[model samples]
Target: MATTWYAPYVAKASGWLSDAVNLADMAQGSTVNLAVTGLSRSGKTVFITSLIHNILSAVHNPNRMPLLNVVASNRLMGTWLEDAGANRLPRFRYQDNIEAMAAGAPLWPAGTDDLREIGIEMRFQPATAPGKLLSEISGTPATITIRIVDYPGEWLLDLPLLAQSYAEWSRATLRLYRRGIRAEAASEFLSFMGQHRHDEPASDEVAKQAHDLYRAFLIKARDAYGLSHLQPGRFLCPGTLADAPFLWFAPIDVPDNTHLAPNTLGALMQERYDTYKREVVARFYEDHFRWFSRQIVLVDVLRALLAGREAFEDQRLALESILQSFRYGSGSLFSKLLWGPHIDRVLFAATKADHVPDVQRDHLAELLRSMAAFPAIEAKSSSARFDVMPIASVISTVEDTQEIDGQRVQVVVGRPVGSDKQAKFFVGTVPIRPPRPDTWNAPFLNVPVFEPPVIDSSPVDGVAHINLDRALEFLVGDRLR
Candidate 1:
């Protein structure tokens, strides 16, 4: 009986050992699993589409990605999207998204709500001595395969659950739901909790009702309040596990250390919660996330700023919490063998840079750095290369100037989605650090969602972008060489 359960883990450990041994082997080629990490509305889909398109375009016109060393040096020989096999996850809808953005009335692609991966193949002339030596032996340009994994940001908020018991998680989560703006969003769930005691007899219907209310609260917090830190993420984006029995439980009012009697309601909920943590959260780490060698944590900083102070602070906490799930540091054979591959490079990007003028873009990036507490994260993981920048997957607005209240102000010009004419929008002065509590006095930003600019269906001109090349260079430049 023990052998059956232990056999899978033994095989997994053996595979990990072999991979660790081959971590430094580049004689054949290299593979980069680029985890496109983000929270709700962080523009993961658009970023992936733009990145793939730009890479393919760079093969024809190197100017598209001049900042990437491989392209600027003119050593990039060819680039193409890899064909997804049956074993692969759902392929990212790159072409469908491109066509939509190029339509008569363009629409931005849908946000990522399911797991998907897209691969890009790059053939490059060897720039380093070792790479040249390997290519000479193979009689061809060296190759690199980049795999990008995209999933719902809601699930990201669940990573911290791996460390908490069901009761501890319940206490912490219930406490959070009662504070500040969340108090109103979770009113129904809290009211429901008041009537249902953990000591009651086990009832699936009652437990399922609690789960329904919690799921409703998450949507309310997200849609109505712009909140991102919701737990049990599968409730929001279940994908294939929509009907899983283990997800039918919700946090009930209970003591942090209390273990209810067997066959009681509390015990049933605890069983489900433990099963969820083991089967879902831990499975994600072992199978997909831990193998990622690089990461890009995208943030919709502009939108978060406009969402109000409570939301802005909530996003900060959520991002910091989500970042804890990643293994950061330079990977060694021993470390990889024990902890799988650590993400040696991390890029934190403020998405939608086109919403701000060039003068304020750097400020936006700086604000994101402070919001994510990048310096502290860097200080802890000294060996990993961490950088933050402002990037627009597709430039949607043009820089212009406008006078407001008899003062000249830098602004961006674009047609808001529903508007018939273009208008200038000034986002006001962006601060380099998190503003004081007293400073969030009023909404200084009056920006609107701008229509996506005309884009080519093919990678001919490569969709107009802001600082994407520079970001990509920081992510995969070393591997290219």
Candidate 2:
């Protein structure tokens, strides 16, 4: 009976120990957050869906050999499943897209402002013993939560404003509208800037008008810029003035003294740009971006390069600007904020590589490396992850071959809307590694085969199954693990 008394104490101690173990497990299994950003029409949505699909496929498979093999080989833990906030991550939903898929039509994404958070649970099956396999597949399951924020790419431009002043932002915006390869509508905003500059000692109404004018111009440029996927969040809306007047600066104009009222249009534009950059973009970066552990920056490298030299240079400068914005360098104030944490890994992808022949895939990676231009890191240990891989989101499904004299060439065919389809040879080579400066001189197409599509379905003459799986691997592979 005396020895039995110790049993109660042991049970009490074990209860507390169990609670402690649960807490530790939670701390170790903290949720992983990822941000996916790319240019409009890049395969972001498809990639995310494919990643989820593959993970689900692996989880639900009755034949547990792959899981067993991975576990036995130490590639993974046991497998299980959880609700990846199935109802929450609306952006990843494929049900709405089935109509477009079934019809063999190009799919447009849902509007941007209405982005939804998606949560999925990744079930982890713990390994059997140190060596032995309990079962080829595990009957038990453990889970980790994955949270993702799906926003339209247009919103990505707002991230860099934290560092810029309104004047600087205005000058920069004006320069881009004037010298950049944007649509002509952007010029109208400049006229407003010119007028506001002549009004001395500007009144609040003048400043507000300039702010509204600048926003209107941005909206017009976005609409007319031939990039139709512009409506993400209404952050660009002219009148959400919670902290509105702060963004009421004007663009700076060169000195052309004609009966001046102080605070000219140039001044007004500069101030508004500064406020927008600082208050708006900075706030977004602070609120939405802090939790990201990984990020993928999708770019249209080939498209920009193909637009010829000036366009290429503009894109190059834009890339540099973007990279500098994200980097946690000495002068980067955002990085110093509680919300501005250093990104663990960043993957810069060249999208729609499938549009070109396989032979030139490596060249895309090389192009990306050249474009990245070696970000200035806080430390060498502060990793700057980058890659250039071809992804055909909406695949061109034709195996186009043509006879050039005596030689036969397999090509990819591209078509403008309502235009005749033209063929470009498929470069079978896939990208093998990240590009570097030295790689730039080499042929862009010679890299190793990254991943090729399996071609699950038939093409609609010119349409094909894009290498979306490869994109998924590049984007969420590590996260899946």
Candidate 3:
């Protein structure tokens, strides 16, 4: 691991300037940077699209979001998207996504692979009397600019690589692959890696072969076996770096104490790994992550549960590892003034709650909390407020009751993807905690993909959801005041 190259220099030169600019903004109005991320196929795109729709819609139809205090108190005056400016990051396609969902035959928006941003201006009356006095004196309503950033959760799994040496990462990754199901899926790649000699001179053909096989294994582990702990996530979703040599290295098996000679395969691989951390991972932290004041980590608990015991546990480990990136603690004012942004609030949300019956939603939330209780994560929990809840950004199912074996069972009814006919799905009760090996003997739950419910084209009606307002209130409610 290497120290971020620019940290010390930036701390010394820009500390006061950055603090003053932030303080000045806070006096007039506040800006909140909200980061939303989740694993592949975790419905992040849908969540963002639905959230924006609901907020903009609440401006005209306050009744749609009664759980949000600003709306319930009749203080939400207006909401609208502002121009993101030219030559900046691309804007999130809010209209295109909503239109797809509202079409005669709705479809889910495409999943995100690149970074995008959207800014919304929320104008509202001040909730407190003194704040109201200030607003009246200024002849303007209080405003908060909410900036939402969307990116792949795969990229997030790479953050921990910043603190790990190539040798350390290789040993850990190799050990993980030898475990229960991963051993079988990763056998081909493992065999190839074992055949190479790390001390030998570097060869492009050999390196490419190793990289290709390892990438193939990652894809199989994710798509076929439902594993979540894959590393160098960009290999799986290589947005713009598809052909770059920076992504051409693979982990090699080597003795812990061995030293590599110059120009050897081991030396070349280590150099590329260091370059990756210094360039790709560090730039992301500096540009995007360092500014986020609030974060939402979405999890597809139901999918993991359905995948079986091995997958459920793997997903848990991946989440616990990912949480390390948010572990900054409260420190001295001087340190805070000089340091980059520290996240004060984090929301670990179990998405697709609509896939299960209402009675089982609490179990979903509890499972997430249990997964997030790793020792390292719990230590950070003391510094920041962590909230765990179940949310469905878009409600695609309606509840119904069915008689089974002389008993009534709650079920969710919706149209499965690619099918014109609607069907009822019943996933067995979700465990409140991770189930032990012996107790996890139930059949895999057959949760079906659901089509989005028909929605009116107007944003005022908004999109139907579950717990989205409560989640929003917890993340940025105080800032709104």
Query: How do all models score by TM-score?
Result: 0.90, 0.66, 0.90
Q: Positional deviation of 420 in candidate 2, in angstroms? A: 10
What lDDT score goes with residue 225 in model 3? 83
Candidate 2 per-residue C-alpha lDDT over 1-481 given as tens digits, one digit per residue, 9 for 90 to 100? 0223433454365553332223223223546676776654445665554444444444333232232233223344433234443453454554454334334444433433334455555555433331112122223333456665655555555555555544444446566666553435656666666664434665678777765665676565433342222221233532234345666654555443333334655455455555566665665666666667667776766655443444455456556655654566544554554344656667777776766666665578676776656543425454446555655555544457777668887666654333345435444333333333343322232212222233222211212334434444454454333
What C-alpha lDDT values do all the predictions have? 0.80, 0.49, 0.81
Assess candidate 2 and give its TM-score to the true structure: 0.66
TM-score of 3: 0.90
> Candidate 1 — what's its lDDT?
0.80
Residue lDDT tens for model 3, 1-481: 1223433444356544343232223237677888888888887888888989999999887777888999998989999886777625778888889999999888888766777889888888877654464466556778888888887788878877877888888888888898888998899999988888889998878888888999999999988888898898788877656668977888998789888778888888888888888878778777777888898989999888888889889898889777766765555221342257677788989999999999999999998888766445546543456889999999999999998888899999999989979899887788888988887654364568799999776788898899889989999887666
Clashing pairs in 1: none
Off-target runs (Cα >4 Å) in candidate 1 are 1-27, 327-338, 381-383, 442-447
Model 2 CA RMSD to the hidden true structure, in angstroms: 8.7
lDDT of 2: 0.49
Off by over 4 Å in 2: 1-29, 58-92, 103-106, 111-115, 126-140, 153-156, 180-185, 198-250, 254-275, 336-340, 375-379, 404-407, 414-481
